[model samples]
Target: RVRLFLDVLAAVAHAHNRLILHRDLKPSNILVTAAGEVKLLDFGIAKLLHDATVPAAATEITKAAGRAFTLQYAAPEQLQDGDVTTATDVYALGVLLYVLLGGVHPTAAFTTAPLDQMRAVIEAEPKRLSDAVLLNSAGGAAAVKLKQARALRGDLDNIVARALKKAPTARYANAALLADDLRRYLNDEPVTARPDAIGYRSAKSLRRHRLGVAAGSVVVLALTVGIGAALWEANEARQQRVQAEGLIEFMLGDLRKKLQPVGRLDVLDAVGAQALAYYAAQDAGRLDADSLGRRARALHLIGEIAERRGSLDEALRVFQRAADSTAELMARYPQDGQRIFDHAQSVYWVGYMARQRGQVPDAEASFRKYQELAQQLTRLDPNKLDWRIETAYAAQNLGVVYLESSRSAQALKAFVETRDAWAGIVEARPEHGFELGNTWGWIAKAREALGEFDAALDAQRTKIDVLRKLPDADKNRIVQRHLAIAASELARLQLALGRYPLAGRAGQDAVDKFEVLVATDRANAEWLAQMTLARVILAEIQLALGERAAASASLDRVAADTVRLRSTDGTRNKWNITLLGSLLLHRLALAESPAPQRQDLEAYLATVESAVSGGKPLDAEQTRIASAVELALGDLLARDAQPAAARGHWQGAAERLQATADRGELPSMTLLAQARLRLGAKAGARSLAQRIEVSLYRHPAYAELRQRLAAAAGAAPGTP
Candidate 1:
């Protein structure tokens, strides 16, 4: 469907480049040959856009033809007898794309009275292609229908939405630009239509934010002047090894503190290169211990720079070298705990890189080894604050790996241990509240993964409370970021728990804070990107509260911001997933019809399954989200006309959650009970529900599941 649209788009764009507008674009006029070629027919009613050289080639055709274009495919301008331009063709193409992908007209549905057709064309917004597809396919044959809607949900939906803007000036400028966006979507690249770039914009933003001056003024000027001056000073006297070393150290250390914040990564890259080169030429065998130590530190700094630049491969290589150096140093000074600490740090970074790249075994191995070193450090000095905190960090990182890999029970246990460790630190030191806040955030995530929604909400609130304790926290950048993250999390948890008012407050708070961060550092594109995500969350909350217009406006505003953010986003997956997630939520919310008795769960399921199955398999977070949708689908099916169909979806939810249940996660255990109960395995459901009754799960539903199971087991004949 998309390829065919692209083919037609190419033909139209070609005509557009020649100053021709296909004023009437629709499926009938777009013919596809058996040979897979596109033939755009009927430029008979097409207009020639104004050109000074060709006075005869004018859009006076719209006046002469008197709305001669097909009414269903006509743009708002044509329906209103307004000036026709390239945007008219863009709008028609949008309708054509809608028909091709969704198998429905974009605007014809609103004009059942026929006489109101012009009002529908000139003012009524069209149903999003995704929604239209599901609604059109509501007559059964669901799998294929669901698939089509899913395919049109995200970027395709955004593209269509842009093209169908009511105001001509708001639609795509021309067919070529629209085609370019479509091409970007097909290539799995960021589309200009709905851009939230993952890299280029971020570096640009960071450069401006880090430096008071323009990005080029600081980055380019610093690279040339610093590199030239350093090389000149060092080469002027080759014997000045100590002086050269001092100069390099200043660049990496004190000077780095000043320059690094300016976001001129090139300066550090150049300095690191020179420092590494200098050390590479030196005779390590003859070097004093202090010089050797400095060399190791230099490698650590360089590796960190590599990490910050998202060059994890380079970082891992450099960190390994540093670890080797630290290993040799530890051998020389076996009693020096600091040397052990240094090696441990290097190992931790290596593990982090491995985890990020999805090398699970390597990440686990490194984290285990890192945990061992952290333990040894604490054992050597049980009273040391830093060593104990290191131990906590190691455990926390291990929990992240376990959680990501679906070991929820272990992840929860590890996070709880880390939380306790941080809590103890805060109790004794009082100054360590920040680390406690961090631990609580992780705990919230683990709880959520296990389906302990109520507990997750509590943990998230606890995390926010911890962040709120810092003196003048709102004025502190680090605290502000933590608060924003925590508030965003709280908003999501509250929304899941059906606590809209609280969700709204937290969501609004998160959006406000992130916006403030954007203002504080205008060059920091990340802040803006983060703000967009926060706004999406807020919009979801608004939708839940039935503030549809406000929710829609927020989404509309965010659509324009995403383009710039994707460029600066380090790992584009998060922003892309967030955007897609927003679409899914919006579709689900709107799919709730005014039927009074039930939501359009089939539509909801179609949308959810579509999103989860569209491209790459859903990640863990998305899979969890899809599981929730499945559970809802099952719930509806159990009481609906076709009760037996509920079994498959319930079983799916149970099967997906079983891994966590097997690991003894209480929330998953309760969820499994619900699924088992719905599946008519009364004894098994009761057993599972009883097992979770002892947990500290705050929600009454935990115990309610047991009661429901018991009641169902003792019910009237033939309940299943």
Candidate 2:
């Protein structure tokens, strides 16, 4: 089975390398003939990445290709008409692997009806392989025997689950990586698919050594029976002590030192389950303080694993139990600081899970409790730097919840405290550059929310400087992405400050960085998407600086890349493509100013209308893009003397700009004023303009519009 799966993966990997998507991958498509050889068959619905004859638009391609896939074997993306990337093939392979090992399909429950099966493929999470195997085997000849089931329980379960992740980005990057993990499992090496947890490894080790332990127990029991009652009781107590010591030794010495460095937390979960089972089997009256503590710690570890896997309801239940257990331990051992800390940590996770589930009031209450606990811990150990850091983290988490609830003032106060705490930590440990950088980012976000652009810009610059000093490597993709994001933010702040030259430089730097990333990993759709966005930012800066040709070039590149992406993957890039196409049309209108063609104006307006009609909720950045498109269409229509059409577009743009301004975005306020002035509402325009600083009158992007408003208000040209 392993060799056959590996062969299938190799074929999938080859297809991905050629930028080809095997839209239908299933067990039936794989053949094993007489000589124990594996072969992959049937690429009837495969997609070519750069087929010259195929159109660039995904809708056109889909219409031509139609939907031809085996429902049971197809990936969620295939069913939903999403982009069919290499990850889609990985998902199908995961289902195949699941069925091979478990003796039943993971989605068997929903297979009775076609619509139910479709919903299952798109929305349902499959059962873990271990559970599926047990349920399917049930009193019959087990799938691959009982021993194979045991081996598949932990490492194989995690590997299959990862491949079957709902989001394509969350799945294995390609089939080769999935095969590599399987190879590791077959070689008895630690797999990367599972979380690195000491407890889980300990459990596996215990299971492997169970026969030896049982033999020892049998011998001890015989010896105890031969001895008298008093000696027998003493021997039994000593035996229990030995067993507990052995479990602890295996967990800490063998598992922790070995697996923790490799980051295998899923293994720890196995150990934790074994430990919990051991404790549960013991008489409650017989369990000592140490045994109770171990039980609580085991539960905590299991809860953490559940939380990481996004099983929030299960995590909450487990965390609460752990917290209760720890609380009981803390009461018994009043001076045990570790117990107090563990109790607080468990409670904090409970609150975090509540927040994630959107139980706002419950989340607020739990976070407050967590904060109080952390504060108490800090007070008890005033000089403990770890406790102080924990307090700061608690504040930060609380602040995030407050921010989500729109309590900006409270969030800002919490963020300031977090920043101050991290600043002290950085001063004490000069090597804590990453933590310091993150704190600066948090501080900048809070300041920006309060409309303090100057302070936010300074904070953002500090973050960028700190991030730039970090070493760049393939493993540091996250840090590199952060650096790009910081540069983008700096460009936005500079633009808001009316520093056009600085904005252009910052935007171009961001684009350069993203371009490098895309070059390094050309198959990464996410990096490509980000590169497109960086170009969009650069185009915005160019347009604002009156560099029409440069803006057009930037926008043209975005349109071209988006088209290729759509052709390669399907409609996943549709939103971005539509957005870029509209912007390009708008730029062309600007370039042909004084005689902007009516056809071009109508085309631009149609594209913008299509984007709006998509009806998906837009983020602030997307809303700004839509507003800019509207504003451009209005400008073109007005220039062409289409009064009614122009007024409608201007009104739409003004509403969007106003909505953004209401969120305390100062840059949007200026744009709203400009929109009002264009609509001949001089008094309303003047009212909005009065809120901005007079120095902003020098900004070239809106200087003429401001001058026009000034003329209408009977003020001198260029006056604020």
Candidate 3:
């Protein structure tokens, strides 16, 4: 099969060299005869790149550039009507090899709908061949076996991934390069097509030299025994060394290989526990530095397992122990670069886990330590790119802490430095596009918090552009979620800038993307939550346009989904509580509209008040929702001709909004101004209102509020 794939690549190389592109290079295009000779059979859709003259039969192919392509095999650029190139053929070959090796189509998720299948081909990344093989292998003994699954995990997976890179420039330049790498793999030489991770290289080295290491150990053991009683103790020491080596080898080699393909963390947990037990049984005083290092690694793995299982407390304990062990090792081996790096990573993980658990003060202290360690590592090895990246990441995490603590200026400085550092790294290695995109997203948020709206918008657009260029794949859920968030945020900025149509379009696009994701995985609460937020944004846009019915419908769906999710989980999801609050606010708007439903308005008002009175300390988002609900209820009361009651509700809304505004939230400032204006506090209202953009008052829903504010200020109704 390897030889056949090589032959196919050679054929592709030949075609590509002659400026020919075989657009449809699937399995059907290749044939194996009875004598096992490989043949390239089809060129039906092949195009001559250098020649402008087209044959009568090839006319159809030229016309079908965008409209006619195999859905499963088409490259993203081709699907998007971009220029086709040799890389397009490389993408097709990737699909072919993936199916041949993994026994499944890459875009299997969209098989039911032709249009969706095309979209998947255009937007989604194929699963790793090893993962596909493992999934297929789960269909019982009769299913196809990937005997080479372990071997193909890293290098082969990388080669295929490079070939299938969404950006044409990122793939192998031509088929010859891919074929040469395949030949190198066949010759038992190290391939240049894998990620340069230390762990991957270490595992590969162990796999390659296992037998030789075993033989060498035997020779050393035999030679030691020949020295008789004098070396008997030395022999015992050597035996202990061998046992430790075996345990480390088993943990890093076979255990990782077995568990990685299936992502079976439970099995990994058992293996990690056993290794920790072995370390525990050893006499602490007699254990060497090497044994301590191994113990540290085992504890780190156990901590990782606990973290994956959502046992944050246990993860923290084990991770701290791992850090302490590594710190001891570092103290013993102060000049060891590897030990230093390991200790730094352990410390970083401690900080990361602390942050996840919302131990803010602890998280800040740990992250400061992490930053110090990373800075030291970078200084120790100035040319080391990985250490520099780590430093940037540490800074970024610190920035996140600052941002969450509402220290906008400090967060902006940290984010700026992190962005610049990552920009340089990305310039040096464009393959780090995903990380670059994430940095931009962080920068965008920081800029937004600093009220640099124009810069924030630019950063967001850059984030969106970077994410769009990334290959859409199941493994890239983080990237997809970020893209959705950027889009939603863009909509908000656009709305703030008074670009209603663009905001509406962006909001709708966000909703559509999240809907597709939710459809793909209905049980994913994160995606569902994002979808609910997207709907809220869409409803806001609709309300701005005075499309009350559409806004109400959108809110209704959000409310229904929130209710279902809460019921399904058998707990009150706090995010759902926030969503419910938003729904009630929007429902109040709908019920108090021109065709007012007085009963429904009162019901929604009661619900909002009941939720707020439940005695729970609300987060910033929940507080905003509660305040919006209060303002909506006040508006309803004013419209009902109960002036004194309306003033009381408005006063309460003003207090909530004022409290929220004091937290440095922009939207709350505007709402507080409106609330004060409604309560006839014109002097205070004008002072607060000066901070708000006039574009907000231009929205139809805010028109009445604007008029009242103008009236209170003793200005004409149409005056700004």
Best by lDDT: 1
Candidates arranged by lDDT, highest first: 1, 3, 2
- lDDT for every model? 0.70, 0.67, 0.69
TM-score of each: 0.49, 0.45, 0.54
Q: What is the per-residue lDDT of model 1 for residues 1-720, given as tens digits with 9 covering 90 to 100?
A: 677677887788677655677787877887888998899888787766555565553535446764778777778888777888777888988887887677777877634665577777765667777888888944357787788778778899888987887766556667766786788688664453542233323433344455543446667767655655565444334324433553455456544554544555466778887777887787766664545565677788887776555455677787787777777766777656677787788888888877644456678899999999899888888887878989999999999888877777788999999988888888788878888888888888888877787788888888888888887886777688888988998887777665779889999999888877666544444456667778888887887687987887787667677655544432333444445445444545554443212254455445445544543234455444555567767766666766767778888988877776786665567677777777778888877765665444433235457567657867643221
The deviation in Å at residue 573 for candidate 2 is 13
Model 2, span 1-720: residue lDDT tens: 777788778777777655667777877787877986666688777877654566659646654553778888888877877777667788888888887777777775534688888887776667888877767744267645566669778889988987887667556656766887799688654554643234433433344565664566777744533443445345346334533533443353334434433445445666666665665566644555545555566666666555543455566777787677777767876665566777787788788766645455677788888888788888878887778877888888888776555456778898888878887987787656666676677677767656677788889889878876765523466567767777877786777667889999999988888876665555444566667777877787787888988887887788787775555433221234345544554465456544335565456556545544643233344455556667767877777788899899889988877766676554566677778888888877777666665433334445656687778878887655
> Candidate 3, 210: how far from true, in Å?
26
By summed lDDT, the worst window of 10 consecutive residues in model 3 runs over 568-577
Which candidate leads the pack in TM-score?
Answer: 3
- Cα deviation of 133 in candidate 2 (Å)? 44
What's the CA error at residue 422 for candidate 3, in Å?
Answer: 0.9
Off by over 4 Å in 3: 1-362, 470-475, 518-524, 548-550, 560-580, 592-623, 629-665, 694-707, 711-717
Native-to-model Cα distance after best TM-score fit, residue 109 in candidate 2, in Å: 59
